[model samples]
Structure formats: structure tokens, C-alpha cells
Target: MSRHRTIFRRPILLCVDFDETITVHDTTSLLFQLSSSSASTQQQLVTQYVDEVGEFIGSYETKWRQRELISSRSRTFDDAGLHEFLEGYAAVDLRSVQRVVECRALEGIRHQDLVKVASSVQVRSNYAETLALADDWKIISVNWNKKLVESVITQAGVVHEPTQIIANDMKADQQGVTTGEINVKVQSPMDKARWIDNVRSMYAATKPTVVYVGDSATDLLALLAADVGIWIAAANTAASSAKLLHQLVENYGIDLHPLMNCGSVGGRIHNDRPVLYTVTDWAQVQSILKSPF
Candidate 1:
């Protein structure tokens, strides 16, 4: 059982990340691998590009640039050309590694081991507990893969209308070919902040307390914007590398010590505004919410 607080009359706007946050593995990569046999090779190239450029080259601009660059050697931007361009740049072929990760993740969920472990630590089951908590709050998933998040929530027994899921819109042409490659037009950090602002303004009369729960640095902007920021680290791994990198660049100071620090477990308040808490299990999240604010 969980406890509820009455002082907070404002509805909480709960935002979550999709990849590695809710699901154990990135679903998009899984879909790509399952979609085609050459998916592995394509994914490898993309990974290399992202690693070298520090940005996903799934946009029209990137594609155009790649096409132009390869035009001298190849006449068309076919699969091979694309692969070659990608191979010249990405870090790792995430698609190749997704299967093993997804399998392990599904096993954990199917055996109820994750839930059991979470319960042991006093954290409620993520899907169930979150569903229960949604009764009073507006829960939205800010993820790169909106459809995948929708599927997860639906599978969890929660009915979320299409409009409720916020993400970058992907459209394909009539030829059944993706007009533009899969790209995150609105990034997680930007979207989280934008959504929070929108919710705050829309419900200004009620002045609801906004809370954002996430496992990566992509959620940092939203976390900072929210009344509460909850960081979940089930394996004691910090998932804020992107944010840390941005911070380092902005500060122009490179002392790897702070970035490498994993810090302690469990959630706690920070900066007097948004409460910062970390949990190894979701049950701890439930317990925290159950505790008096």
C-alpha cells in the first residue's frame, strides 16, 4: 500500500524517458534489427557516425550532406552508400547488441524478478505503481520512440490516448520509404522543458507541482524545470553522460573526477526547489511517494 499527501492539490505532470529508462533496451534499435538482415551493418555505421559527430545523423540535412559527400564515388544514396557513410563515423552498432539486451530485459520482467527486487527495496512496480499514481497526475512519456512508449503503457494496462504521448513526429512517403530518416527533431531535454512550461501555463490557476522522473541527462532540463527531479539508477550507473558532457563544454573545465563520481543511492532533496532522489529499485520510488512530503 502507498500513502498520499493532501497538501499538494496541484496535479503532478510526470514525465519519463523511454530508452533504458522504462524498458531495459532501446526498442527502436530492436525494431531496426528485426526489420531487416542488413540492419546490423546499417546500425554499425550509424553508431560510428554518432560517436564521431556526437549527434545522430538521421536528419534530412545529415542525409543530404552524406549523399553529396558520397556522390563522387557512388551515383545514388542507396543502402550501401548510407552504410559506408555511417561506417565512416558512428560509435557502436547498437542494433547488433540490442537482441541480447532485450532478451535479458524481457526475462527480468517476465519472471517478475525486477518487480520482486523493487518490492524488496520498497519501490513499487514501475508500470503498475506508475499507473496507480496516474489517477491523480498527468503522466506523459518524453521519449524518442513515442509509439514504443505507447505500446509499453498499453501493455501495462494503462490507456493513453495518442495525444498524450509527446515525441518527434516521423512520417514516411507514399512509396513506403521513410521520407526522412528517423531523427529526434525535439530532443528529450528540450521537450521536457517545453512540456513543463506548457503544463504550468495551461494550469496556472491551479499552479500544479511538476515532477519529472528520468534516468538520463536528457531529462536534466525537465528535471531542473520541475518541482521534483527523481533519478532512477537500478544498477548504480549514472545515465547523465550527455548532460555531463554539455556541462563540461559549457564550463570549459575538464576534471574527470566529478563526472566519474557515481555518488550514493536513494533519493534526496537538492537546491531547495526540485527534490533530487536516486533509487536502485522502483519500490523505493513508491516508498518515497508514500512518505510525507
Candidate 2:
């Protein structure tokens, strides 16, 4: 599982997306459940909305509806319409969502409980191997929450630096309850790509090859930009987080959020980039990393 070998003769920079990519469930679901079992705390997120926040979330839901038009059963996402989708999707206000999550979803949640979820949540198969690969190469996690990602990786015994994680954050109070000042970084595919570009610039002298691993359509931009993009098609599997996500959305009678778009099965979309490799098992990832392709 150790990525001692790579296709590039130069150094390798491995970028992994968090959420369903590595974890069995969306990290938000795990974190959202950490709050107290009070009725208000357990209420639907939309129910907690207010003024501009409500409007922002409503606009975000429009993106969700657009994804609905794509059909949950379809696995292949055509990039032909992807540009238009991203243009409309650019309207999503991530800071608003971050604020909502911090103020509402994490209201009654204690910092200790948040840390505890790092161990309680399920880690995908070959996670140790993934971490091992990171140990031997430049690895960074791009996710929505910085603190949550750091805790999960740290608790898993991976010694990744805080800076290695490009994500958003919400501070906590003295009583171990989460508080204000949301610092968001990786909210969209462009943001994720920007981090990769920054890293690429930093390692310009070494001319490192960037390899990105992600599990959903949200990683499309980063995937397209990478020298090698590996898509983890674990969504429709028996233990797929995407299945649960589909079910959750169904219960609410809504379409999958555009950001949560689980692209088609094991196939390449033939985008501007040569192609993207899709894998259901970690072994496939190991195989790809071991070969020149």
C-alpha cells in the first residue's frame, strides 16, 4: 500500500478529497449527529434558516434541482453541459452554508463529541495504505472542514500537518462548543483546483506531478487538472455513502445536491484531459499507482 513507486520520475504530490472519498459517510452527517438530541437541534437544516441565509440556501437548492435533472441512476456526467452547470453553481455562497452549519447543525455539538466522531466514523478500506502513501509523498486533504479532517487523520495515527489540509474552519469556545469566524478555503472544484495550483507553484522547481483522488463529480475540476486523476466509484456499492445520500434526499423528496453529484460507474468521460481512471476498490488505486499507465 506504500506508494514507493510512481509513474513520474520527479516527486509526486497526492491530493485526496475527504468526505465520501475516504470516509464511508459524508463527514457532515457524522459531524451533524454530534449535536445534542434536542428536538430543535435535530430539526432539518432548512428549518433553521433565516433572512439572507434562507435565500442563499434556496439558491443552492436550485443547483440541487439541476442535478436532479441528471437522474440519480445515471453514472456518466457529460462535461458538455458541465461548464454551464458550473457557471450557475458559482452562485452558491459557501460562507453562508458554513455559517449555517456552524450556527445551527453544530449549535448543541460539543468539541469533545466532534473529536470523538473521528474514531466513531468508518474509514474506507485501505485507508492505512493511503496514509502510508502520503507518508512517502506530498499529500494534502481538501475538504469542507479543517478541524474535523485534522482530528480524523490525527486520531487515525496519520501525522499530517495542519497546513496539509486545505479546508474551511469554525472556531470553538472555552466550553468546548464551536463558535464564530468561519475560514473557508476548499468549497468548490475551482477552490480545490486553486490549492493544487498553489502547491504546483510551490513545487515548480521540482516539477512534481499532481495526482488527485476524489469520489464524486465535485472533484471534476481538480481531476481534469491533475496529471493523473483517480475517481473512487464506491458510491453505488453495498456500503456506498452515495446510496445513503440518495436515500436521505429521497426521504426529503429532493434531488442530490450538485456538489454531491455521484458521477457514473467505472468509465472515463473523455474530457479535455486524456482520461480519468475510476476505481471501486483501493487495490485498483494501488495498481494504478504501481504502473506507468
Candidate 3:
């Protein structure tokens, strides 16, 4: 007797987040630190603000409420005021900034092992093959820095088409490069979600199978909107908001973080919704696609 396979007819819309999800380092933060003259000081200030905001957001029962409050205040807080608040209240680590910068600067530095461990990274495990397998696929690497998206596309050896990219800045040009553009400065998480929703609606068709892969809590709203949601685990430290979101998902009987070290895979159904799978290797992902769970 042969078992029947559920074939996915709709185009697999892969909406991937840039930061820690695709790139080994957070390119937006990297660019911010690199662009800043007072890199060390600025990094500390930013980190502090992030921590404080994260803590505050995590304290709330509904994360969306916290996001709304932040968005409202962000409009009032000028760049300088935001910087000051971060420095005073958040207490960021300068080392993290320096490390990110160093990692970004290193040429030919591929986190092959990490890439091998997590199938989420854009370049790893024969991305071209996966792209070819899908009937139709579009990769949206969302981030505040557009340059990072360009850099990743260049490094991945994939054709960079402007219609394929969505980012915040136009400070840098992808001239003579094939890459799509959706210029919108993503100052806050809400901005990110809004852009994602806009993109989804713009490309709306008959029950499009949208998949969103992200590594931070900022991506939670967009992920929730997607037909399939993938949460990529960050190295070392877990972003506070993301951890809280994971806990909330767990409360609903979903195991967001399944793999312990790496090279493990597990998934579970939540509320009779889409199957949430934790993948640690690109090879496993390929295998899954070849013969889906």
C-alpha cells in the first residue's frame, strides 16, 4: 500500500528576515555601528535601549500593546533623544557591537557550521536547488539596512533582482546589480510588520501559502500573519521579546524551540493549525522538501 502525499499547489512565498535569520551577524546593527564614528559609544547606547525596550515589552501580557506604546513614543523620541535614553536606561554592551562589526568586515567568512546547523540561512544547502524545486518562490529579506541585503545576495551567488528585495535605506545603491527595491525606513517593529502586510496584500492570490522565517520578536506579528511561521534560534543569547513570544506559543502547546544543540528536528501541530517544525540543518530541510512531513 502506498501513502498519499499532500502536494502544495500554491507558490511557496518565502519571507525571510535578514538579521540573525539569514546572515550570521545582524547586518543592520553592523551597518549602524560601521557607519557611526563613535561606534563603541553608539553601540552601547543602542544595546541599552534595546535591552530596556525588550524588558518593558516582555513585561506586558499582550506584546502588541507594548509594541504600540513603543511606536507612539518612537515618534516623539528624536534620534538624539532615543540615543540618550538607550545609553541611560538600557546599558548596552560595546563588545557585542565590536564583535558584530568585526564579523561583518571579515571577507569570505562563512558560518558554514552554523549554516549547516540551521537550514534557515539563505545561501546554505544548495539554495538554488530549493528555489528550483518550488513551483514559484520569492525571497523577501527584510531589514533596516538595504545594503546588507545586497551584500548577502552578492555573496550567495544568486541573481540580485531589485524586485526581490525590500529594505529601509536608499543611502547605498545596488547599481549594475539585479535587485528589487521597496524603500521604507524601518525605524520600529511596527514598520516591519506593516511592510510585510503590504507585500502580502500586494501579492495576494487564491490562498497564497506564505511562509515567514525570522529570528527576533520584531518579526512576531508578520510571522503570525503568515500561513507558515518559522522561528530561527539565535546564537548564545535569546532576544527577550522572542523568548517571551516562544513561551506564549508554548502555552498554546507549541514547541517553537525544539533542537537543543543543533542537527535535530522536531515539530508539532498547534490549535489544528500549520505544522511548526524546528530544523537545525539545511540538509534536513532539503530532505523534508524532497519528502515532506
Candidate 1 Cα misplacement greater than 4 A, ranges: 1-8, 34-37, 53-124, 135-144, 173-185, 236-275, 291-293
Clashing pairs in 2: 75-264, 76-264
Best by TM-score: 2
Per-residue C-alpha lDDT of model 2 across residues 1-293, encoded as one tens digit per residue: 66675444555667888777777767766655665444455454535433443464456457657767876432444444454444444434454465455555555556667677788767788865764653233334444457677777777777866667777766566786665345566666676767778888877887766778877545766766776677676746554334422332232332221212323312333322235555665655665454333
Q: What TM-score would you give candidate 3 relative to the actual structure? A: 0.57
Model 1: lowest-lDDT 10 consecutive positions? 251-260
Q: Tens-digit lDDT track for model 1 on 129-207?
A: 7646642344444343444455565556666667656665333445443332343444445556778787678778766
Highest-lDDT candidate: 2
lDDT of 3 by residue, 70-95 (tens): 55222221324223332332223333
Off by over 4 Å in 2: 1-8, 36-42, 46-80, 90-103, 134-144, 174-176, 235-274
- Residue runs of model 3 more than 4 Å from their true location after superposition: 1-8, 54-58, 61-132, 138-142, 170-193, 205-207, 234-244, 251-269, 272-275, 287-293
| Residue 54, candidate 3: C-alpha displacement in angstroms | 4.7
The deviation in Å at residue 155 for candidate 2 is: 2.8
